[model samples]
Target: MNEDKNRIVSHGAFVVRYRAAGAYRFEAHSHPYLTVTSVMSGMLEAEIGSSHLVAAPEESLFTNSFQSHSGNGSDLEFVSVGITAEAVAEAAINAGFTKAGADIAFNNSYSSDRSVAEIARAIAAEVLSEEPGRNAMLDALISQLVIVLLRSHLRVKRSPLIELSRAGPVDRRLRRAMEFMHDNYSRDLGIEEIAQAAYLSEYHFARLFRRVTGVTPHAYLANLRLEQARELLINTGESISDIAGAVGYQSQSHFTKAFKAVTGLTPKSYREGTTRAVEPAEAGKAGLESSNKVSSGE
Candidate 1:
């Protein structure tokens, strides 16, 4: 895939474009760019790692950097606009979302005929016009697209079935224990160490931890390690033994057992299950090297 060809138009910081033709099949790939696709006149299906969704005319989708997926249009007219990943991250931070997890992957299919057709017409008008402030015009249109999709996305409300009005003594202790566990999951951890981290006796900490998170501290640690291991397995070429050690498992077998227990697949199997190659333009720009530095507090 040609990164330059993928980039349609760059307005200040955001790049925008549309897709209409081409076969509906692409290998799994990732980029350091942000992507927002507005289905103009046909249906498109996308696979993000293990997740899948479909978008119809006037519907939209958003993806963040290094997201692995493949897509194709069902009919002829399918197009999408993309922005750089850095811009989206900056927007997320501005929106007060700190731990901006993975890319925001979602899709919306139009249920009402009139609405879908109207949005498609609107998109076509915008794409064809060479009016002044066209870039800004596209930005506004994309923003509206995001709003429409988000309004359709389902968000489950926290259960009112159980409520905690105030932090009880047990709750306070458990909260502390959870914080310690999150901060120390990469290290060689123990129940005793975690209890001490929370200033609680071992027995009390173990019981309370289970009550809050629905899992024992040790079990929770194992889950965290597995998640970290999976991330490394998919994103990096680190050896299995090294990844196991880095995430706190002393033995490769132990890590493999726990990983399979949680994810239902061995580490190697999970990695190979979705072997997405990066596009050359994206790969060339990859890495974490910083060109400039500034001094911190004295």
Candidate 2:
């Protein structure tokens, strides 16, 4: 089995990423957001907490905040939509869910909702295209998915007030570290430096940081740089090498490899909005397949 090649497209309220067809397995981990993965092809076998589930083409799988999930997929290609808990809460309120302040969770780990499948495919299309109004279109599509889940798939867990009030000194220090990273992401930084910003020893900072954010400091910083690089790719006409330097990558080759590894497209290709991995025609066929499955009661 090989590692999956991932392509990410970040939006305001949600992030959509595509995992290329391959055999891959991931260790048990958790996220602070709601993830809805729509299988475009092949099958996904996953374990979310205590439940074991399989999602097939035109079906979707859900993982709510901090719910431990691990999975393996064989020849699997999918688009995963990650919506923050905050976004879900907002949608829940809009959908008339009374317990919006409580923790939001999914009632089912797997979904065969036709509407969700449709919207997921639409989002994939938008991601693969450079169509005008792409941002607006994605916002609308993601909103529909959230609304559908709120109406049919959500459950609320009443949480203790104390849990919400855990923003103690240590948490404040973590926030400081995060702010430091954000402010200095364009420069080469080190773990010791970041740890110093949090006013903790490197060992302590690393441990608490992962415990809080679910990723190592280095991984977080890499993601931060890539995010900034992505914005530069989309919004500006900066040359690739200059953007690479601005994002703290010392060399163009290193920056290109990192960008392509995460995005499945070279920086040049992404900036051009011409992804050769999934063509427009192929994406359209996927949309049709999802629609046909709905009509045939699959």
Provide the overall lDDT of each model, using Cα atoms, as 2-decimal numbers.
Answer: 0.50, 0.70
Q: What is the TM-score of each candidate against the true structure?
A: 0.39, 0.63
- Candidate 1 TM-score over all chains jointly: 0.39
Candidate 1: stretches off by over 4 Å:
1-175, 273-298
Clashes per model (N, Cα, C within 3 A):
5, 0
Cα deviation of 34, candidate 1, in Å: 23
Q: Write the per-residue lDDT of candidate 1 for residues 1-298, one digit (tens) a residue.
A: 1111111332323434444444345444443344555565667777765568787765655554345556655443533444443444344445443333323333422233344345544654655454654444555665554344334431212222222212211244455665676677778887998899788899988887665544567656665566457557755789999999989888999988767644334677656533332223333332221111111100
Tens digit of per-residue lDDT, candidate 2, span 1-298: 3244555665434667777656656655555468898998888898887789999989999986545677877888788888866667666766677553465778989889988888898987876566655655666788888888888888855543212222211234486787788789889899999999889999999998877655678877787787678767765679999999999999999999887665545788666532322323333343211111000000
